[model samples]
Target: MVILSGLMFIGISIGLIAVKYKEAYIGLIENRTDNLQTPSVLME
Candidate 1:
């Protein structure tokens, strides 16, 4: 029973980590695109 509970806790932690990583990855991509566009806009 203890082993099963431990496994469940590990699974939940992994899932939370994955979700946070995905959000961070997407935010980085969006920030990059915004930065790229801003330079072009300033040039014009």
Candidate 2:
């Protein structure tokens, strides 16, 4: 019973880590897209 509970804890931790990773990846992609749409240019 103890082993099963330990395994369940590990599984939940891994799932949470995966979700955080996905959110970070999506945020990075969105930032890149926004930068591309509004590029900065120097005015002379």
Candidate 3:
């Protein structure tokens, strides 16, 4: 039970980290696009 709970906690933490990383990555891309004055559709 203890091991299972520990694994669950780790999984949740990883999921949160992944979500945050994705948000940060998208934010960086947006900033770069704005700086370059390029159309955002090009990014897609």
Candidate 4:
């Protein structure tokens, strides 16, 4: 029984970490897109 509980806890932790990583990855892509769309006045 103890081993089963430990396995469950590990699984939950991994799932949460995976979700957080995916969110951070998406946010980075969005920031890159925003940077590309804005024109630099210094360049003009």
The best candidate by lDDT is 1
Per lDDT, what order, best first? 1, 4, 3, 2
Off by over 4 Å in 1: 40-44
Clash tally, candidates in order: 0, 0, 0, 0
In candidate 1 the C-alpha lDDT for residue 10 amounts to: 100
- Pitting candidate 2 against candidate 3, the one with the higher TM-score is 2
Q: What alpha-carbon RMSD in Å does predicted model 2 have with respect to the real structure?
A: 2.3
Q: Model 2, range 1-44, lDDT digits (tens) per residue?
A: 99999999999999999999999999999998987788646521
lDDT per residue for candidate 3 within 24-44, as digits (tens), equals 999999999886896667578
TM-score of decoy 1: 0.77
Model 4 C-alpha lDDT per residue in residues 1-44, reported as the tens digit of each score:
99999999999999999999999999999988977898766767
Query: In candidate 1, how many Å is residue 30 off?
Result: 0.5
lDDT of 1 by residue, 1-44 (tens): 99999999999999999999999999999999998877776576
lDDT of 4 at 5: 100
Off by over 4 Å in 3: 38-44
Name the weakest run of 10 consecutive residues (lDDT summed) in model 4. Answer: 35-44
Report lDDT (CA) for all predictions.
0.94, 0.92, 0.93, 0.94
Weakest ten-residue segment in model 2 by summed lDDT: 35-44
